[model samples]
Target chain A: LAKTTQPISMDSYEGQEVNITCSHNNIATNDYITWYQQFPSQGPRFIIQGYKTKVTNEVASLFIPADRKSSTLSLPRVSLSDTAVYYCLVLFSGTYKYIFGTGTRLKVLA
Target chain B: GAGVSQSPSNKVTEKGKDVELRCDPISGHTALYWYRQRLGQGLEFLIYFQGNSAPDKSGLPSDRFSAERTGESVSTLTIQRTQQEDSAVYLCASSQGQGLYEQYFGPGTRLTVT
Candidate 1:
């Protein structure tokens, strides 16, 4: 599995855009970049996923550079309820396992 | 319209006891997964099942942990001789299939062993 590195925590206020980046230098050609949001005492929810370039959904957007070695999750007009831990995972090829790193904790302040 | 569901939302057991955690995936979902989240720690991959085929048990922490899925609907994770270290939330998720699908997770079963 590809190892990912991200910030431990981040702070933001409501109505501001929050961007979290993840680095996966050993990403494989068949690997996909996926992001999950986890609130306290709940399971991680899927936010966005992308193989390359950009993919936008109703909730968030994922931007992957041409190199596919890194990706960014962009959330617009954040609110206090958006405070949660964001995980960037690299799904292994032909396997059921996805390696999750420490993840970036986004604290949305009022 | 129902999402994934897990039974025994919270379980308290003694050491050396056995516990079973159940997961009901969304209807039509073919891929199911099991993960463990210890306090102050990241999610740990446990196992994955696709349809009725053999599950990938490589991620299981020890021989004491095991899981079984019936058809493509329900799964049960069994822990034998549970230890204090087994205290954590066990999460279950299901996806449409491989490549680019978003996984839907259940609320999970919080197990505490004393």
Candidate 2:
């Protein structure tokens, strides 16, 4: 089952910071939260992942609280090319099935 | 160093005909997965394979859908008596490990059933 839920869509302007939050209330202790960014006609690309605290990469950052009930993906600066669907996935250690909830459509406007 | 690869980037078939899709996961990656995404919809998990263990087919919509993984590399998803509803983009992914690791996805195969 899909354990995460995110907003249907969001809009942002160029050079703005966009934060997309995902809620996985029943997340298991062993589960890890990962995020992927998908562009038109292409596969989803791994952006960032985190178990707790925060993880920052060249492209994005992932922040998770101690409770792990929810997580946020932060994109520092937005551009027109950054417009795509962002998916939040709950990855279970035992089950290889990556449950992807309906992702948030991010539109970066100029 | 190659990522996951899938065959026949696009396919169009008659409603009653059968079709086969192939996926070649990253070398030495222990896990492979299949997912279907329709237009304007989230990905729907189809199946998963890890190592030599049995595959998890719970996500498959019907018995006509079956997949097989050879060793820890190549995998194939076959659909018999395809229906128009089966039209969607089939995506393949693999991870070095499950859970704690992130999955790398391949360019999906667009299937159009008529």
Candidate 3:
């Protein structure tokens, strides 16, 4: 399993774009980076995923550096509802096992 | 279509007792996983089952923790001789397949061991 490192917490104002980055220096060639959003007392929901370069979805965008050692998750125009724990995971394509790190707790302030 | 469903949303048990948490994965999904999350902490992988292949039990914390899945349908995680540290939310997720596919999670079961 590839170990991931991310910020412990972050704060952002409403309507401002927030970006949380994760570093996985030992990422394998077959690994893929994925992010998940979790609310209090509920299970996590998938946000976006990427292998290389960048991938954008309706809810968020993922940008991976050329080395694939680090990736960033960008949430555009943050809202109070977007305040939740964001997890950056490196999925091992061989076994498909996910090793989740202590995620970044994002707080959107008004 | 119903998403993954876990029964006994909340379980309160005493130490040294045994408890079972159930999970019903989405129809047609071939991969199932169990995770434990303590308050204000990240999720900890528990066990994984894929099709009829032998489960990967490397993540199980102790010998007292075990899980079983029938075919590709329901799965049950059993905790024997639970301890106070066993208190946490038990989450279940399933995907069409393991590799590169997004997992759909169900509302976790909050287990409080007294």
lDDT of each: 0.90, 0.90, 0.92
Query: What are the iRMS values of all candidates?
Result: 1.1, 1.1, 0.9
Q: Give each prediction's DockQ, rounded to 2 decimals.
A: 0.79, 0.80, 0.84
lDDT per residue for candidate 3 within B1-114, as digits (tens), equals 399999899999999999999999999999999999999999988888899999989789999999999999999999999999999999999999886889899999999999
lDDT of 3: 0.92
Residue pairs that clash (backbone atoms under 3 angstroms), model 2: none
lDDT of 1 at A57: 96
Q: Deviation in angstroms for A52 in model 2? A: 1.3
TM-score for candidate 3, please give it: 0.97
Task: Quote the lDDT for A32 in model 2.
Answer: 86
**Top candidate (TM-score):** 3
Instruction: Quote the positional error of residue B65 for candidate 1 in Å.
Output: 0.5
The 10 consecutive residues of candidate 1 chain A with the worst lDDT sum are A93-102
lDDT of 3 at A65: 90
Which clashing pairs does model 1 show?
none
Q: How well is each residue in B1-114 modelled by candidate 2, as lDDT tens digits?
A: 488899989999999899999999999899888999998999888888889989889889999999999999899999999999999999999998766667899999999999
